[model samples]
Target: MTPAARLSAAIEVLADLEVRRRPVNDALRDWGQTHRFAGSKDRAALASIVYDALRRRASSIFLLGADSPRAVVLGMLRLGRGLEADDIARLFSGERFAPDALTDDERARLEAPIPDMPAASAGDFPEWLTESLERTFGDDLIAEMQALADRAPVDIRANTLKTTREALVSALAHLSPEPTSHAEAGLRFHAGDDGRGPALQVEPEFIQGLYEIQDEGSQLAALLSLAAPGEQVVDLCAGAGGKTLALAAQMDNRGQIFATDIDARRLAAIHERLSRSGVRNVQVRVPRGRFDPVRNPQVADPLADIAGTVDLVLVDAPCTGVGTWRRNPDAKWRLRPGALVERLADQATVLDRAAALVKPGGRIAYVTCSLLPEENDDAVSGFLERHADFESVAPSNVVEAAGLPHLAEFATPGGGLLLSPRRTDTDGFYVAILRNRAA
Candidate 1:
């Protein structure tokens, strides 16, 4: 398809998303089903346009003086794809299968120099988050949030249980894999101009479980748990067992990792992943009846046999996922105020659950892929206040012991670590380690 046609398709998909309030993938799928003539390249291009437009949605709307789908696409052409006015004019020339000719206002807005926008508008984040972003990032809020609006780098961690990072790097040398700045087992892949990364899943090494796709920040979160050989660790809310597998490798197959989640369907994939990665130390514990509210509540406790014996309990708690904007930009726009409140409640519940499983002198690594202070430091602080037996452990010590001392710069005053695209060149992640004192 011509670039103009792809832009039109993206506008359609964006409109569908706005009206239906459905996920980007669902909207794109519906578009593909209706437009059977669109080839793989055309679909890919359209999807890229839609995602890029969402990434700069706020700034695009501000610059174009309208919030219409066409305005976003037009503004994104200049702002995100770096196309000139002449280039955009060629596409929106009212030709067949192309968008309508630019109106006088659009043309004027296009030609006008970009005006200084509010920080939230410039960063493409919600206006409500301005204060929180300010509190979290201080003077670097714009820089940090703007970085999140860009594409995320593809990151993969070598499965130390199956193969070494050196060996995996040699096997995937064709992808120009570079060692991650901080994650010892992680390799980074920058996206191409087309906004697509290497398809490592099809590689023989990947199929053989030599590596798993994980963000550098996530890898560091698992490391902060400090799970070691012969220790008993419980990965509370271990969706798909990504970190559970990481903990297994860290323990050198000597410790026990009880990976449990409220929803068993999420654990279904972990069994295959564990088998693929040859991880023997992890036990995928599933609650009976899976995710049904009534059934889930009544299900037998999967970890009943191991409570209070855990050396470490890692609560990779769910949250608003603001840190993953680079990968799922549309989600940023879809997020509502109610969702943040809900996630805060879930984080507190998961942290409390982790506290119950940790033995005296054991630790809990509370983690979230959220940059919001309310979900990160505030959540940890509230939990500490509620449980007098648990006290904060300086995350700087964890970073230093993990041999990533440079990350100490992100240590919070309340004794947690915050990682962001600007600060750590990684997805937004917050990790706080808490130790349980003996009674």
Candidate 2:
């Protein structure tokens, strides 16, 4: 399909999403099913336009002075793709399969000087999050959130259990992979102009489990846990076992890792991943029966026997996923105030469970793929308040223990490392280490 035609299709898809409030992937898939004639390239191009529009949704609306899907796509062409006014005019020529001709108002708006916008509009994020983000980032809020509004590079971690980083990098040389700045095992691959990366899943090295597609920040989070060999660990929220596999590798297949999640469905893919990565130290513990800690406090848990004996407990707690906006821009717009409250509650519950599993002198690594202070610093503060026996590990000490002294600069006021796209060239992640002081 022509570029104009693709833009037209993207506008339709965005309109559907705005009305139905469904996921972008779902809406795109439905559009594809209906438009069977659209080729793979055409579909991919359409999706790219739609995603770019979403990535700069707030800014696009502010620039165009309208919120319609057509205005969004048109605004994205100028803002995201950096197209000139005449270039956009050619595409919106009202030809068949092309968008309607640009109105006189659109022409004037597109050619006008960009007006100063508020932080939320400038950064293309939810307006409700401005206060929290301002507190987290202070003066650099726009730069930080704008970085998140851009596309994300595809990152893959060399599975140390199967091969070394050097070896994996050589095997995937065709993809032009580069080593990540912070993560020793990470390799980064730039996405194409269409906002898609190489299909690493089908690569021979990937099929052989030489690497796993993990964000650099996520790899750093797992590494910071410092899950040493022969140390008993509990991956409290081991969804899909991404970090669980990383921990098993760090343990060199010596110590045991009790990997489990509240939702069995989330754990389903873990077994296959563990088998592929050649991880032997992880024990998959699926919930046996109905077990809601709040509803039935006495219900048996998978890790009940190992309570108060674990050397480390990794709480990769769930949050609003604001950090992943570079990859999931639609989520930022879809996020509501109620969702943050629910996540805060979930983080508290999981941290409490992780505290129960940590032995004396053991460590609990509290992690969130969120930039919100409510989920990061505030959550850790609340945990420290509830468990006086557990003290927040100093930023210097935590980074030293992880052998990543360079990260000490990203230390938060509440005592955690904050990694972000602008600051760390990675997805936003917050990690804090707490040590059990009571013997």
Candidate 3:
């Protein structure tokens, strides 16, 4: 496909995104299914263009004095992608599905946007989210948000118990573009020719459970939890067992791992991952909502069995995934303050209930992907204050021990780590280990 046609595809998908409530990824998938002839490169190019347009959606439209996908794409080509007007004219030329010829005003704006980008616009987020972004990121919001606007690399963590970094690297040779390990077991593969299949699904090693396709930042999340071999641990709120697998591998399949979640579907998904992972220690625990009384035996009530019994608990609590905008950009536009507040209510409830399962002196690694303090720092402080027995620990010590540098600088005053996308070249994650005091 010509560059122009690819741009045309982006315009179509973006228009669909604007009109329909469906996510960008969903729209792109539906679009691709309709056009099966599009090759991997063509699909990737079109997808990239559409996402780039979304990232700069506000600024691009504002600059071009238009909000349509065509106008946005035109502004993007000139501004974000550094295309000349002639280049856009060539791409959007009448020969292809590209937009009609750029209007004189668009051409002029293409030459120069109002300014580099106003404070709110540079973040490439909705104006309403600006206060939250600014509050969460402070002076660094622009830098981090800009990074998010770019493509997130394909991150994979080699299950050290099953495969070494070198071994997996050899296995991924056919995937082309050899992967470079960010941390000992973390691999980042450059996006390249893959026939448009889910990258890891095709690899035999992945099928055999040699590695798990998880973000490097996610790998760090599990690592920070410090699940040692032979230690009894409970992965409270383990959705789909992404970190549970990592914790299992860390335990060398030796300790008791109580993996629990409120959602049965998420727990059900972990079976395939666990079986493939060869992790024998994991015991799947399904929960009845906190309101469910113990008299009813029909619902799963595993959290009741282990209250104050485990040495460690990993609370991978749910939150607004503001930290993962690189992968799920459309969600930012969908979220409202009311919805976020409601989610926090759910989080606080989960935390209070989960805290009961952590034994005296046991550590609970509180976690969230959100950059907002409401979901992170505030949550930790509230939990610690409400439960006098619990004391917070600085995550920098754990992170630095994991070989991550410069994070010690962001350690919270009371305790915890606020990882902004700017300081950490990874997702926005807040992890704090709190230990319960003895009576």
Q: For each candidate, C-alpha RMSD in Å?
A: 1.6, 1.0, 3.0
Rank list by lDDT? 2, 1, 3
Preferred candidate (TM-score higher): 1 or 2: 2
lDDT minimum window of 10 residues, candidate 2? 289-298
Q: How accurate is candidate 1 locally (lDDT)?
A: 0.88
Best by TM-score: 2
Error of 3 at 64 (Å): 1.7
Return the clash pairs for model 1, or none.
none
Per-candidate local distance difference test: 0.88, 0.91, 0.77
Q: What is the lDDT of residue 242 in candidate 1?
A: 87
Residue-level lDDT of model 3, residues 347-402, one tens digit each, is 77777766788887788888888877788878888887788888876666776666
Distance from true location, Cα of 362 in model 3, Å: 0.6
Is candidate 1 or 2 superior in lDDT?
2
Instruction: Give model 2's TM-score versus the native structure.
Output: 0.98
Q: Write the per-residue lDDT of candidate 2 for residues 149-246, one digit (tens) a residue.
A: 99999999999888999997788889999999999999999988777899999998888888899999999999898889999999988989889988
Q: Between prediction 2 and prediction 3, which has the larger TM-score?
A: 2
